[model samples]
Target: MAYSKLCITLLTVVIFMLAANPDVAVANEATDELQRQIDSLVRRIEELEKRAGQSLNVPPAMAATGAASAGNGALQIGLSGLFAGGGSSVDNDALSRLQGGAHDPNQNGFVVQNVELSIGATVDPYFDAKAHLIFQIDSDGETVVELEEAFFTTRSLPGGLQIKGGQYFTEFGRQNKRHPHSWSFVDQPVVLSRFFGGDGLRGQGARLSWLTPTDWYSELIVGLQNAKGETMTSFLNAPGEEIGGHTLLDRDARRFGDLLYTARWLNGFDLSDTISMNLGVSGLWGPNASGDNTDTRIVGTDWYMKWLPARTQRGFPFVSWHTEVLWRQYEAGDLGIADRETLRDWGMFTQALWGFKPGWVAGLRWEYATADGDTATDPLRDTRKRLSPNLTWYPTEYSKLRLQYSRDWTEHLVDGSADTLWLQVEFGIGSHAAHVF
Candidate 1:
């Protein structure tokens, strides 16, 4: 009888509290609604996974919270800032030739390498879109703004086919499409700077990619873009620019054949449980401004290999090697002209990175470039080589610190060689997409 009276008293107290506090009843109802929504999202995700025959691997809490916030056509915005401070053995004027990349830290003091604003989102069910805008202060303290990339890609296409359009980086090589923040080292490769100019071959274009249904991963990409611009270094670059002793003319794309044509075939394989590799070949063809009838052709091949142990801590303890070789043939003058000749240039860069622990990576790179001529006096075509060693530490996913040293050798420099040391820092905010491997 005493136990029955105690239970009656507790029930009466709960009823009295609920009656006195109306907010508690509303809070309980809201929580139930949120739980229902989470359950619905889980079911939808499971259904999608079943259809795709692969696990999305999304944690339940993430799906219910962060992922849900991005649902229903919400836009994602991100900003990244990269800065560097360093000194070179040579003066700033001479350092410009050695550090050829536009974004590379060329001066002997502090530099704002890149400040990028990235925006991306899904456009309904058929397409996805993204844009990158860059802001930088030049050596002369002039603020410059540029539309780095603005592109849209098809979301779901049949037969593993996809189409991309608008101003985009040409799918020429592994490094061409990567942005400055994604680079393993602070500076661009010497060969790439010479061939693609400091901007790395980007223009208004459209491309089609096909994912082959092979056992091993394989992809074929073809693109067509306007071949006249400063970025099209091997093609119709800016007027007054000299290449191979030939002054570039103001050339415009008058027909489809004048546009740049690009093709690439990339393949990936798993050598073992702990090893993976990617091999690719790329080519470009376009008209040159050296003469009305002159043209340019470029070909390149790239290889990458990575090794990781079975167990990892935050993707630590891995080694990766990357190498690329490129060749270019330029028709310097019109056929039948007295000065007509073909200019042949080739270059290669190989780099290796060791992730010795979580958030720490050490890297070394070697580069070589030359042309088939007496180009000792020409900075662009002269024989050049460089070695760079760098160490990077990532304190968090959104921030990093790096230190690098580069030793450069060139025929055009009076000293024949130079050394450079750089310290770089980077930070990001907002939801940035993961970079491509």
Candidate 2:
């Protein structure tokens, strides 16, 4: 502190001396040299102060915006939100419960769908971490918070291999790994909801993925997760109830081998300069939590193709088509007066999205499912189908407005047909990572 003051005093003295003795050539030249030295010292002091200010956290926004420089790069922190409100005309509680209950499409009223917060940063030379939190309104119109995803991924691995560990969405099908806000439409496909529940299957586990050295993009992924949670519809190993002097299966009685296991193979092809396509096949198997120690298995196939003209590729007016088909089998012991039985259920959905102009897109989707088994209260027993068409306007990369209409048909269930119209607006306040392709 004393040296800084002394230097300032010396600089002021030289400036005054130079002004008072302008005619003295020798003194003027010496003073000019002194001035240069003083200027350099002042700049060095300013740099020291700037670095000190950073260490002291003088500006909070720098940290909040993830602009603070760290070892290798700036620390990353971000928050985003989605608010959805729309009315439905189906107006039948029973049908709503049958379809999705609280997340049903037939329910009439305004509701908040999702408000998400995401944060992430590199932990060290070996790994990086991220967490996504979600908030929404429950069936009783109460606010609730849910942890959507929290995981750590390996940063430096050899042989084109990567590892991830945490509670995350499994890569079972095309759209299960994505959040609702990132979906092309307002609701998930009917098949996904019926097969994996409203929230796609996710649990605490570790995943390993390897990229093959092939001409076309090829990769394989495998994972093992705890076979529990309400989202595990076909394999919840909890205790069952007693109805009419009969007890359902108990999942806890099974061994650890009953844990859910998943695997997927992905491949991509560049059909031409203006077109590309992706194909994938996935499978999930685990023991059903029912006390009977029965097992469940599910298989899925997905395909996606996109086309863009070479001339407008930058601003990219593009058309894309995606489709997924799923099949599930459940084996169970005697629940009634019968022997062992195997029931099969399957569903498929196809969609197309066209970007006719910049920031404007339109899409159409068709979904169908059926359960070919003998069960009196099987939700998937009847033929269920829905057709939806939607229009969307993206004001920017971080915000969008969408309007959609859907017509649903239930073949065997009573009062099984309905129509619904929806409007949604979504925006983000902070930086967010891009969605998976």
Candidate 3:
């Protein structure tokens, strides 16, 4: 009896010990699973932070430390470019204009060509920076390159106001920002030459623009420009100049070396969304455009309209027109000196673009101009006229082919006239922010 009682008591004691420590087994099983989940969460958080840093273009360490450096604040990087080349001809008896030689062809010694590159990025939701570079070569393979523009912009203001700084194109007319590559026509209207002196309108300046929000779009721009324009020293006989023989705008003498101003206003409304029209009026006032101390002032307007219907089963068709009239007021006209100021300058031009296909377009342009400066003695008596027509075909989003015919009339340096006809082949592309023209 004593032995049995002892054995029973021992077994009861063992069972009690096991029951008291039941939580130990459960904790061991749950702890491993919970620990695994915690580790995964930590790794996931680290990856997310890394990606966020990259999106801001911020250095990972800097991001982690929460510092906003200028180089690391960009949100997106943009790239754009163009390449265009074609042949040209004019009548032998017509006035032959020697454009920036890079656009010359062998037949007429005036081929068409263009090459451009641009880089842009948004530093923040409301701030941006842009840079444009150009490389153009004539049919003879002579090259001329330029820095088209470089500017920084910010829009952190009330009523969508934006401030721009650095060298920029004046918003005097449509073509300042109206890139030829983005245009449907192969050539610009004649008015641009009279109003803004074509590409010479580019200037070193600062501009401030305010864009108002609404279905009716509106914007205002003011510019303070360097009246000397593109310096002849940067492009000419100063040595190392690759201008296919000569540069375009600098053929004339220096006009203004200081304070030149330009201002523009834009207003437009949505013509049922698919079709729209905009009107821009601009003015530029400055001194001595011809280096004769004869103050020069010009004013003009630009109109743009687009038409796109909801249904176009037969591809897409649209028409566009650009026109301008300019009257250059000369403070000192009809001076007796041989190289003296002789007359006021005035000219008018209009052009149209028609789309035959999504990427194909046809264009026509015409202009009449009379400048008192052509002949240093009789700047006004000289009348210059141009008539141009062009057709283009695009095989892809990045390529274009164009054909153009034109006539010119100028009674300047030569006699009656000279003209010719030309056929050209052109290739273009937009990639990697660089162009080959």
TM-score on alpha carbons, each prediction:
0.84, 0.79, 0.64
* Number of the top TM-score candidate: 1
Worst 10 residues of 3 by lDDT: 232-241
Worst 10 residues of 1 by lDDT: 2-11
For 315-350, candidate 2 gives per-residue lDDT tens digits of 559999999999988775645637556768889999
C-alpha positional error of residue 301 in candidate 3 after TM-score superposition, expressed in Å: 1.0
Could you give candidate 1's per-residue lDDT for residues 1-437 as a string of tens digits? 32223223322332333234334222223334333432443344345424332234556555334322454376765566676767788999999878888889888766668877777899979999999987776788666778899999998999999999999999887998899999999999988998899888999999999999999999999999999998899999999999978998888889898999999999999999999999999999999999988899999999999999999998899999999999999999898889999999999999999999999999999999999989998999999999999999988777777889999999999989998888777766546456579
Clashing pairs in 1: none
User: Candidate 3: how many backbone clashes?
Assistant: 21
lDDT of 3 by residue, 178-281 (tens): 55565544455444533454354666667778887766779988877666643311211122322212212322334433356778999987778577777889
For model 2, how big is the CA root-mean-square deviation? 18.0
> Judged by lDDT against the true structure, how good is candidate 2?
0.68
Error of 3 at 407 (Å): 2.0
Model 2: per-residue Cα lDDT at residue 395: 76
Pairs that clash in candidate 2: 237-289, 249-290, 249-291, 250-290, 250-291, 251-289
Would you give me the overall lDDT of model 1? 0.82
Candidates sorted by TM-score, descending order? 1, 2, 3
